[model samples]
Target: MSVTNQTTVTEFILLGFPGPSSLKLTLFVTFLAVYLLSFMGNTLIMFLILMDSTLQTPMYIFLGNLSFLEIWYTTATVPKLLATCLLETVTIPVSGCIAQYYFFFSLGATECILLAVMAYDRHVAVNRPLHYSVLMSIEICLRFSAGSWTGGFIAPLLPTILISHLNFCGPQKIDHFFCDSDPIFKLSCSDTFLAEALGYTCSSVVILTSFLVTMSSYGKIVVTIIKLSSREARKKTFSTCASHLTVVTIYYGTIIFAYVRPPAKYNFTIGKVISVFYCVVTPLVNPLIYTLRNKDVMKAFQKFLAQKRFLLTRNMHKF
Candidate 1:
């Protein structure tokens, strides 16, 4: 293959949501609010997991890792998107754009594996109740969590490196909020057949494999739940998995719609809307779902608040 002359594209102007000035401000404010809430929610989960001794189980440990991933995942792209909404023309340097794409996808891949690991954890908890503690010991949980992080970080490296080396001759305006692989690849002037092939191959392997594992774990969980004689037992068991199932459904649904297809068939507007759901909405809602549905989390939160109030009252009396 003959090498095309490398493009002089130094920066990419992000053509964020195209609309009236009022719409821009509205989007900016909306995204800013979402980002802030996502940040706070994830941070709170991490903090609670760290502070509450009762939450030192394998489930919460995995959750803490997930919260950490969510914080950085949203951080990778949301701020830049917010900036583009506010500024008339927001340009990211080529290197910065590449880095953003790499991290965004890497973090997302990490979440994918993490979710599957969470499913397996739940499966073992429900299926092997007698050996739950033994099966999911601290060391084992750490290994699973570490594997997710490592796999997530390494999964996109090859594709990202391949795409980065491709030539972008001109037309550096990306018609989306962030520097995603599809948008960036579209801008490349070089022959992108190999890059595209590699991307699809990697995505299929990561997404399909992780998704299958999660589904299989849930499948076994469903079978085990069915064997429970008491309605209450079954209901309680289902509740434990409910929040995770909801999150997995929303996350994988949006991701499958967005990336698991040929780029030629991609609808930019639809993709952007779905991207907002997974990228912006899911992270914000995850903690809410888990905390609200979880009795333990609620009890812990109330206890934390009560402790703070008691401390304040005592301090005031002393003063």
Candidate 2:
């Protein structure tokens, strides 16, 4: 490729949900509330897993890693989106834009891998209950978690680097709330076929491989459940993985809809709506999904609250 008179753009204006002032204000308030709630919910999950001994098992260790990831995952984009809602002129430097895209997609990749790991964890617990301890020991779980983080962070690096080197000769307005790959690519003057191809390939590898691993693990789990003789036993076993299945379905559905296709085919408007579901809504609902029906988590939470109450009562008696 050749470039002539490269007046490379330095900054990008994010056209985030353009509308009347009333609409902007409404969006601002709505996103701000969602962001706060998502942050708190994920943080609480991490804290609970850390503080409660009952939650220190392999399953909850994976969950704690997920909670920690969700915190950074949402943080990578939501705050900037909130700014875009409120600010009339929201601009991010080119470097900053690339950084945002990297972190957002990196965390997304991490979640995919982590979810697959969690699925494998579930499969081991269900299919090989006797070997669960040996297979999913805390040390092994920690290694898997660390591997997910490392792979996720590394996966996006090449595509991001290539995209960063592209020349954005003009038209610095990105028609999205945040620095997504498609919107940024749309603004580039350089020939983007190779870069886009690479980006999509890397993304597809992360998404599809992990998705297949999760599905395969779950398939084995389903087979194992079906082998059980008692009807109640099958029902009981399926319930253990039901929450994970729900999360995987929602996460993979929205993510595949948003990212699997070529950027050239994207309708940014529809993409934005889908983005809201996975990027914003999914994180908000995850803690609730994991904890609401979980008897162990409920009991642990009650115990924690009871301990706090007992301490307060003891202090009052001392006074």
Best by lDDT: 2
Query: How far is 134's C-alpha from truth in model 2 (Å)?
Result: 0.8
> Runs in model 1 with CA error above 4 Å?
1-7
lDDT of 2 by residue, 1-319 (tens): 3458767789999888878989989988988888888889889888889999889999999989998998898888888788888888889999999999999999999999999999999999999999999999999999999999999999999999998888887789998988998998888888888889999999999999999999999999999998999999999999999988998999999999888986778998998888888888889888888888778888888888999999999999999
How close to the true structure is residue 303 of candidate 1, measured as C-alpha lDDT?
A: 83
| Steric overlap count per candidate | 0, 0
Clashing pairs in 2: none
Residue 187, model 2, lDDT: 86
Candidate 2 yields a Cα-based lDDT of 0.91
